[model samples]
Target: MTTDILTVSCPSKRGIVATISSYLASQGCSISDSSQFDDVETGTFFMRVSFISEEGKPLSEIAEGFTRIGAEWNMNFEFHDSTTRMKVILMVSRFGHCLNDILYRWKIGMLPIDIVGVVSNHFNYQHLVLSHNLPFHHIKVTKDNKAEAEAELMAIIERTQAELIVLARYMQVLSDELCRRMPGRVINIHHSFLPGFKGAKPYHQAHKRGVKLIGATAHYVTAELDEGPIIDQETIAVTHAQSADDYVSIGRDVESRTLARAIHAHIHHRVFVNGDRTIVFPASPDSYAADRVG
Candidate 1:
């Protein structure tokens, strides 16, 4: 059987899922997975469905036939075969926590992406990346040669055909040109939840501010620096008894997973951009569970 995945978004209306499911069933498609969300505030409907067909129909046929339903519902729709994987390049300066997290998940088949290479200004993690047989590029950036370095990075982005760039802890601010060029394709993991703690030493800032929570933010990279549309965020408890360094160490775990999950949703096409925020449809956690005690 041939399997195809579809994603759709449109104005809120009754029976959108019924319309889509009925059309697929009529076409001999059997749904294997599905997810949907309704935004009451915006009155928008979004859905993602995966199905299989016994006739081995070509993906093009599925896409083409779906267009009529798309027109009828006035919906924006996209269909793709499940075999495609998004191309991603990782960027880091010296920190390895987030980079290590992504690599581990990718190695275990939890994250779906093609890790083209790892780029860094420092050589700290080159051996670690190379040990996994992934390409590593070292491009040092300084005040005198920042522009040239950015050009070189852009060249690598173009050469590798990377659809998404992840700044795991790249430390350096990107050029406005690159930010504009990439738009919503770049994802950054901020050490803090953001808008609350906004500069360097965010953990320290949190400690100083005496906040009760320490959080992380994963968002699109815009020219505004940490001000782009938010894709995912998570927070953990902190208290007046803990120091700043403690927050940094404790926050590491959440930051990495938060960013990786954001990338996961993105590569799976389960994320949608909406205003300065995002819509993320998560896979069912229960379906992923295993190893029940016998």
Candidate 2:
């Protein structure tokens, strides 16, 4: 009854699936769900399997046993205990819609992540963040001391031992050094109005342009500022009659849901970065079951 997750990636070859499934069966594990992908263009293979150890074997032992198979196939693989929650750090600025939505989901156990702390450049949401019994660190950033500010932020990340950082609506651009240090650990969410609408009041710009679609993108943050590898995206149909304010309201909903979905896939080990794109596997059975219903 104890579920375990196994994720594997390697060069494309035949019998990869048979080898993995046979290995699991040999270890007395029952496969509950499985997803796989073979990228013909890249000649790469990716697989994620959710299974239960019928014999209640420890994760370390199972992982150790898989080394032979992994070595034979020249594969990069990981074995994870599904019950362990991923540690996460949330960074936000003035906008709190995505932050608020993630907070609600975490509070209700709908999101299985340990929100270790929140980092912010502004103090606007200090009270809101603290109310959740989470630590809040306020590190002000300016053009003059961006490097110093990043150092302080890195200290917090080290202290908390966070595995992932979510930029709900953090407005500051990260340095290339930081991006290179932790490649896929940071995720950011923003309204998808680029090229059509730029700075502040994007919804207004969309309204003026008579746009028929409004959307949001959640992606891994890279040095290129919003050009990171996209993990998820969602769009909503907009009518010409809707005002800019209506656009903002609808866009907020889309942003929250898209970011949440991306985070869920990430923490569940169902997402893989494949070159500039991604390979996101479907959720396993009961993966979305919340601890409590509102």
Candidate 3:
């Protein structure tokens, strides 16, 4: 039984679900799990459907057949074979907690992504990235050579034909051009404190203010620094007793988990970019199944 997923987004209209369901059934596909949203304010409809092809129809056939429905609804749609893993490129700076966590998940088949390569501005994680038999690119970025560095980075992206770029604690701010070019294709993770805790040792500042909650945000990278459409977020309760160091430690765990969840939602096609926000659908029943228990 081959499983396939179909994602559709378009202007809201009547009979969209019925039409889609009918078409899938006409093709001998049985829907296993489905999610849809109708935005009343925006008048946009989003849907994701996971189905099993009882007749074992090829994806191309199913997609080609759906073109009629797509055309009728003026929908932007995609059909994905559930077994196909999305290719991803990871960018990281000196921080390795998120990088390390992603690597472990990828290694254990928990992430289910093909990590084409790792790009870093420093040599800190060169050895670790290589240990996994993955190519490591060291493209140092300086104020004077920022453009050149990004060019080199784009070259890698094109060469690998990577589908997504994950900035797992990458420190440098990407240029507006790069951000515009990638749009929702690039994801970044950072501490959730912004505006309140501006610069340098944010945890320490939070400690001084006696903040009760610490969290991380994973969002699609945009031109306006960290102000992109958020995909996932998590927070941990903190008390007055915990020190700044404890905040950092707990925040690291939150960041890693939040980033991983964001990546999972993205690779599985569960996220839809709405206006300034996002429409994230729930995961399928088997989405969390890893190949092995480690």
Candidate 4:
């Protein structure tokens, strides 16, 4: 049996589920797990269906068969084979908390992705990434050569055929041009909770404000600074007894957790962009189950 995941987004209407199930059944598929959402406020519908092809139909054939249903319902849909892993490029700067966490999860099969390459403006993590047998690109970026550096980075992305870019605490602000080109393909992890404390040293800002809660946000990269469609967010309670360094320690854990969860949804095709927000469905059964490594 071959498992394939189907994702759909369209205007809200009746019989969407019936149409999808009926179509999949016609393709000799049986739904093993399914999730759907009807956003009344946005007047849109989103769904994720995990099904097994009992007759062993190829992904292309199954997808081709859904065209008519897709057209009739004006739906945006994609069929992904469970065995296919998404190619990704990870970018990071000084902070290695998020990068290290992602590496561990990827190695353990909790996060399923092919990390094709790691790009960094600094050479801090060259040995770390190289130890994992992954290609590491050190393309230093400075104010004087920002454009040239980005060109080099683009070349690496193209050469690697990377489908997604994960900015795991990369401090450099991406130019508007790159953000426009990639649109939904780029994901960034911000230390702050977002729309609250943005920009450099967000932990310090939060500490100064004397807030009781500190959080992190993982969102799609946009031209605006730290303002994008939020995919996942996490917060931790803080007290005046904790120092600024303590806040930093707590923030690091949340940042790693939030970013990992967002990427999990994205790579699994369980996330959809909805205007200024996102619709992230629950993970399929056994998604977080890991294959232990020695």
Q: Specify the highest-lDDT model's number.
A: 3
Tell me which residue pairs clash in candidate 1: none
lDDT of 1 by residue, 39-133 (tens): 89898888988788766777788788888889988999998666676789999998899999999888877776789999999999999999999
How far in Å is the alpha carbon of 25 misplaced in model 2? 0.4
- Candidate 2 on 86-201: residue-level lDDT in tens? 99999999889999999999988889899999999999889999999999999999999999999999999999999999999899998999899889899999777454675688
The weakest ten consecutive residues by lDDT in model 2 span 285-294
- Which candidate gets the maximum TM-score versus the true structure? 3
Winner by lDDT between candidate 4 and candidate 3: 3
lDDT of 3 by residue, 39-116 (tens): 999999999998888998888999999998899999999999878888999999988999999999988788999999
Give the least accurate 10-residue stretch of model 1, judged by summed lDDT. Answer: 285-294
- Write down the lDDT of every candidate, Cα atoms only: 0.85, 0.90, 0.91, 0.90
TM-score of each: 0.89, 0.97, 0.97, 0.96
For candidate 2, what is the total of clashing residue pairs? 0
Off by over 4 Å in 4: 289-294
Return whichever of 2 and 3 wins on TM-score: 3
Number of clashing pairs, model 3?
0
Q: What is the TM-score of candidate 2?
A: 0.97
